[model samples]
Target: MNDFELLFDPIREHYRTTFSRIERLVNRRKNYSIDDAYINLSIVESKELSSKEENFHSDANYTTFEEIYGTKRPIEIEQLFNDNRERLLVLGRAGIGKTTFCQYIVCQWASGKLFQQFKCILWIRFRFLNDTRYPKKSNNEQYTLTEVVENECFSNKLTDDGLAVLQFILGEVRQAVSNSLPTILILLDGYDELSVCEHLQNLIDSLMKSPYQILTSRPYNTDDLKYDAQMEIIGFTNDNIEKYVNNFFTSNEPQKSKQLLTFLESKPSIYGIGHIPITLELICSTYGEENKQHAITSGTTITITTVYSKIIEWLCRRYLEKFCNCDKRHLNLKDRSEIIEDCSEILDVIGSIAFKAMEKSSLILDKTLVEKELRKVSPKRPSELRKKLLNIGVVKSLTAGDDSTNVEAAKDYYFIHLSFQEFFAARYLVNVLQNPKRKCYTKAINFIQYEKYNQRFLLVFTFTSGLLSGNDSLSCLETFWKAMTSEPLDLIGPRHIQLIIRCLEEAGSDHRIPQRSLWIEHISKWVECAANDTRDHKPLQTDSLAPN
Candidate 1:
């Protein structure tokens, strides 16, 4: 009869028994219903991130993707909503498990183990709202909070009567001063990716005014959207990393887990980068590849780039196994390379889609777009390859359509993570550049160099640099470096600083760099630039690098 019961029952029933993917082998993927494998990464209270004064400058100096932007003390995920801390914002870098953190909170709440103070918790993924499939209310009026819950969050679309109940409940939720009535908490996921003009401002404004809400996003401008409290998912510590590796490997393969930890221990840089969840997954999964360890260990160096590239290569080998009906692991190097070379077609199509989505600042694309992009590359109907590109687990489905029925149905897909999209985009650009005969090669090269230090494309540039450097294609990346520091009059902005920092990060411990960078190799130069400019007409701000 009550609103909370009406909403919570449907949500709990639909999601309480959700399935998880247990990645056992690089070649095969199996899905089963269980919920124990999530490795709880450290979600620490974010220190008040300094303004554009280049806070990442120090964090960037490390060779590994070292943890940054959080307090020394880590907080339990549940602690986020505890102690009257309602208006909370959770931030993390790309692929740092921000959504997983939110989902964990959801799982906990649904199990009646957390946020007991509220009658129900509403989880909203802004990514879904950005999807074209999700019904858009209208352009003229603000979208109703009721419509948002019914359309965006609810597992099953609400009936007319149910929507009436929610509309009434929301009215009380906003006005209630005490817990005499049923109270609900809101979890806003992907705020950074939210397209604010989606007539959803009313919903956002309502949530902003409420004391019972949590917003999660990739770290962006805190100054734009302040919260009562903020937390950052800084990825796993060593102990948790060990636990994840243990969980990933089966009981029958315990020694394999031990071997991975041992390998990571020996390579501190690789281990440090493993703090990231996706990188850790790639590291563990690819570890099973034939000669993967030898390749990782034998290299003069290895970085996240090495891991990402190997995993894609690994996916190619696995794909070949299905066709050849043989163990790809047993294949010789020459044969494997030849098969992987053949698989470049799949990569080209996937990368084109990824690049288009990135240009639109979108994280998800529907099947129509995929087919359209595929058609441009291949003359035939790229139906089979399209399915492979999507279902392959790297570019994952956003709208988890009935996989048992039609994966090709009206489905929305996203790269496994934003970082994955960036990797594919970068890889695609490299492919284009490597092929001088391609008509777009010059345009592609120019785009990478002169993206105006696009904050959204920072990872793209970093990955591009890493790919070029990792593959001995440094000619392009060095030019990119020159372009980054080529602000007129050497007046480097924070954007420029971040671009340089991230690209340089990809440059370090990157398995292929012949020499290690001190990282501060630019500090002396930066200081010289700073002092070079002192004209009163051009008074410099602390947040910017200036010159005479």
Candidate 2:
């Protein structure tokens, strides 16, 4: 075999096995390929004017382009990658298909369908690298590209001959690099997930000068790095959303898929979230499992928070059923009432973990930490509980080593999506508000005040507001005003102020706030304080200020 083929063959086989195995929903029997369920999303040039900061608004602005432009033309994913050649950076919001785009590139390169200009492609995930604790020594003993490849791609199946072949291939790659040949394409995924490592920084610096490389990160600006070309992953268009929903439901239930399309067409608010692929999947899975007759017969309006709440409920129900049916059944509830309680417990435990992780700005949970946390909640087997979570797609395993090592030692876990993590974190906070004995109200208040949680600030606030507003016995207005005003006015940021205004807007004109003018007077005081404290404060939107 040629040196390129020698290096590419195993890498292709490795990723093909890893990427193709995808599970769609909680109770689904069949798995789909990455390409089968993939919706081809279009990308636009990352203009300075089109950055995320411009899009941040009180109403949860997640658009890709500015409002002045009607629509800029989009380029195909491959064209965007190929156009940039060596140094390309892909930026997107959380769950907007950045990771999936990286996977698609790797899959395409592995199949020999794209990037024919390069001899080898290296796929590196910073999440794993950061978790693995790389750079064992501070000196020049940094990991080589070959070591990374062997560890990530071929560590499980490498034989003595395979090791020798890898060494030879590494030598060939070094020779190609020194000869100034276009021989490598490095795919660096999830830069934001990594801890601050100087070695990683140096490696990124070297890759910037390499012949071919591409990097993906959630939308954030940093002075530490520069790129030749940058593109943002704009999510699905209306047509693409329709196509994705059709693909998602066609195999299992065609009629239900049609009904889902109809239902989404009727509800613009929920339909807007369908433009995001992850939220789109959650919608399909939740709607598919719903009793269609009841949904068709009921007259209730479905909001975004309701959609996520139903998803969580569905996941918990599916998990409980599966656990009861398993051989080591710990939860043997008799009726719906018992099951409901059990489901709440499950969500509480999982939500607590998710909340703690988000506070620390981390995603992956070490198995040991998971066990420690689970011990306080459930005396029953924590591993079994974790397995149930894995089965339901709440948390997924990130297995590192081969089957020889203990699974706990070789594996880490994280929520399936950052959105889900935020949802559960909000759930945890809501539970705290509902029950004071949990005694973490101070922590929750501090969490909301911190700037690190600003990315998910709107989501958590909205969910908490929805929960409070839905309960008749609870005085949502009183509770909300007290919770928001507890912190000093000067300490509150503009995002928090905007969030409060949005929540009051949702509460409507007739909400039981005693007097609308009084509540507005309090909010005006907070806004005035915010304005005086920060020079960058912008006026709150008129719509959000309206009582209705």
Candidate 3:
């Protein structure tokens, strides 16, 4: 056998076995069509790939905001067309129905309603431009924006001679409309994902005067500019949330639905999530299944953490099974320990690199982090790396944001969704902790309900230098811990271990073994060791600890 086959043989076998076992556990017998799987995977693939010629959002199934939320931004969109000479810019958070709204306008034009005056409609997502820098190699499986646009626009070459191509397309559109036949309407979705800065802003500026452009972004501008009309796409309001809940939970009495609605109402963050139809779909799907058993189970609260966990769980159970099965049978990593280790290695690679979670949820640290963290246990990259991570459904390329204009800012990449960060942090904590006692799970449960920052878990590691064994592991944990301890939780810098300790101490009055007590002795021990081992350094958790 060829060397590549020889190497793939063993790893592939192990993966298959591991995946099989996982599938058995989940009882997944039915097979999914390749097209169906690719359709969803493509949505994720599109966001993960940062390319110039890609239109990742083109085939993305989107629902109208008015249909889904019953709130129309069409009037506002139309007003811009009527009054403004400049293009219309619609900016909002992910899942805020940006594409859906654009589609709605297109449909309106087709039916001779809202855009009846417009002669033609052309819709393209800004996601295509993300890949302008990275051309696809023949062997590369990852889809880029370029490939997407080529397929969607029904052309091999992008309209890429800069403004020349755009001008050509615009001419065709304009010609169609100017015949008094209709106004040409062009929709550019996910303008935020378009990373080519020089082209993006300038193209936008030019399009503004073009009389038929509509663009959407997450939140309003970071840069100042004038648009003919700018409309903010807030998520569904409480009424819609309530209606969604009521409609889904037909079996549940109105009272229960009302209670759940009240619960949803109390949290405004849900609005941020509900802006995306997929987020709404996930929430409604989970709620529909769970509500039949129990109305608003404590876990059912639509916190970002809960939503992400469910998705990750689904991915692990559904897709990872095949890889896990292969690992078990071929790699001979039979026990849970081996499985966990293998899993950790996979996560390590993914966590190291800048990856996007599916659904534009979060960006993961790139493979570089893996290189940094597991230099000794080096991973084969490009294909092997992609397969392992994608198998687990943990990491994907978030739509590439523009490399920062500033030198310093350009170095870091971001996950499409912030919630992925929280998920990554939480998973790492669970995996690294030396002990897997049920108490940690209980503590996690309690932490979600009672603890504000999950201090006990944070402090336990903070005080114990050896909590994570291995130099690399310890260094990784310590870096995160130090970053955490340096900043207040509210400020979003690092986890403030000191604050956790302080909170723990304050809880002592209940006659309960204060959570702080658990870590103080351990921390004191570490401090004593540090003093002996290195006289130059002051004790940790000292008053001198600078606030992050």
Candidate 4:
């Protein structure tokens, strides 16, 4: 047999097993399988990207280039990879399906539907690798590509014979590479999550030199990275969004699905945001639950903050139903009332943990840390609460241990999505501000004024401002305005001022609030500050503040 055939023969079974294992693991962790949740979207070729450019600024020409080369003629994901045989970088905004695209590629490859030219494929999650610690070694020591593959891929479920076959394949591939023949495909996912180091950079550089390699990252300044070609994962089109919603609800609950689509159709604002797959899921998941169904059809105004709030409550309700046997449909009126009260109490504790995790910049919470945080709120039954959180998909297992074992076997937990954590954090702060007896109002004010401008706290700031302005109570609006204006002019950056402007705009647009004069007054103060260029407030040259 030829080298490729000999290497592929024994490992084919292992590959199939790995594919099934990954499908199950991803479905379990996400609480939905890709086949069910994925929406096929168009890929836009980035004209500015070229392999010859040593330093490519991804965003420098983005606006002009996109206008020139609109997505009118888009390409398939497979075509993008096939055209760029050497190196490709995929970029997209958060919740735009960069990771999902990677999973889809793996699925296709495993099924022999795409990239048939590649004899071997390896997917590496940079976030997990970044968190993994390796024992110190001598300066001369280095890790090999074969070692990385064995540790990440072959370490799980492979028999001795399967492992031997993998080693033989790697050996042959290495020889082929020396002779300038391509044989492997490497996919590095989540480049932004990786903390850069010389070691990691060297590895990336080596991999980029390979004939087949792909990397995915969120939109950022990419002048430091090297790639042969680049593509952007554009979010769903209106037609695709409708199709996805139909598919999501067709087999499960057709009536509810129609109601959701009708709701989105009526509200153009909500439908605009639904173009993003993650946001669409949030909308569907919230509207699917019986308690939150009213959120869409009840004529209550829905902003991003309100949608997130409903989603948080829905998640908490799911947790309670799983752990406390409190499914509302099966409970009597009194029992339902009690269950809601219990869920409210439990939600406060989970929100506290989420707030602490956000403050620490730690997205993944270890079991010990979760227990400690839970103990702060409920001294007893922290373990039970943790299990419930996991069951409801509020917090997912970061490390997949034996599924046959208890979920407590997981070493770490993280909020299913970063947006959820931010929502809970905002909830915690809102509670603090609304409590008249609490002295944490100043703390909340300081966070919004100082820390919110940081990228890490951007979501927290957005949610906080939305919640504060969305409230009809004059007291809430007064407090938000006061805190925003009280910051010294020198301390407020352009971004901070922009956020304040946004909050004022939201308050003015909120029809429930009768007092537009108060919002106008605060808006005037900030406008004056900008007019005078006070506090070194230079006009922001970007279109980041354009109305969405």
Encode model 1's per-residue lDDT on 1-548: one tens digit a residue.
66658766877655465412333334345432234545667778755544333334322323344536233467886677667676887777766677776666777777887777777777777776653544455556556778667655566668788876677667745465344556778888887676544555566677667667888876555447767887767888778898888877778888888888998899877887888887887887777564665645556566777787778876777666665465654654544357557677788788888887877777777677887887787658676676678545577655532222354645667776677788888888877776667898777756765674555676777787777776656655544454444444225343454555566566765543322243344444544555564222232342232211
**Model 3: runs farther than 4 Å from truth?**
1-80, 84-86, 107-113, 131-152, 155-182, 197-209, 242-278, 288-296, 299-302, 320-343, 355-385, 393-548
Predicted structure 2, TM vs. truth: 0.78
Model 4 residue 67 CA deviation (Å) reads 9.3
TM-score of 3: 0.47
On a 0 to 100 scale, what is the lDDT of residue 499 in model 1? 59
For 1-548, candidate 4 gives per-residue lDDT tens digits of: 66545445434444545543322111243344455555676577766533322122332112222342363357786677564357888887656677777776766676788788787677776655533232224584655555556555543544576555565555535564455443778888877555444455655556556667788876554557778777777777777877877766648688888878888889766776677677787787667666567755554455667676656556556655666677566543333235446676556766777887777666666567777876776677777666666665567766542322355744567776667787778777777777657676777767655664455555566677677665556665556545554434334344454555445443436544333454455446656656565345444322232212
TM-score of each: 0.83, 0.78, 0.47, 0.73
* TM-score of candidate 4 to 2 decimals: 0.73
Worst 10 residues of 1 by lDDT: 539-548
Most accurate candidate by lDDT: 1
Clashing pairs in 1: 301-511, 302-511, 532-548, 533-548
Model with the higher lDDT, candidate 1 or 4: 1
CA error at residue 442 for candidate 3, angstroms:
32
Better of 2 and 3 by lDDT: 2
lDDT of each: 0.65, 0.62, 0.42, 0.61
Q: Residues 1-548, candidate 2, lDDT per residue (tens digit)?
A: 76546656878887777775556645447566777656677677745543223423222434322331234456676676554456887777666688788777777777778776667777877666653445356465666555566776653656676766565554534564456443677788887666555565665555446556778877654335677777767677778878887877757688877887887778665666676677777777767764522322133545455666667656656665565563224333343345546666566777888878766666777666677667777667776666655766678777654433556534668877667777788777777766555578767656654532354355666666655565564543455545554444424244444555555554434366444566577568755755474445554443333333
lDDT, ranked from best to worst: 1, 2, 4, 3
Of 2 and 3, which scores higher on TM-score?
Answer: 2
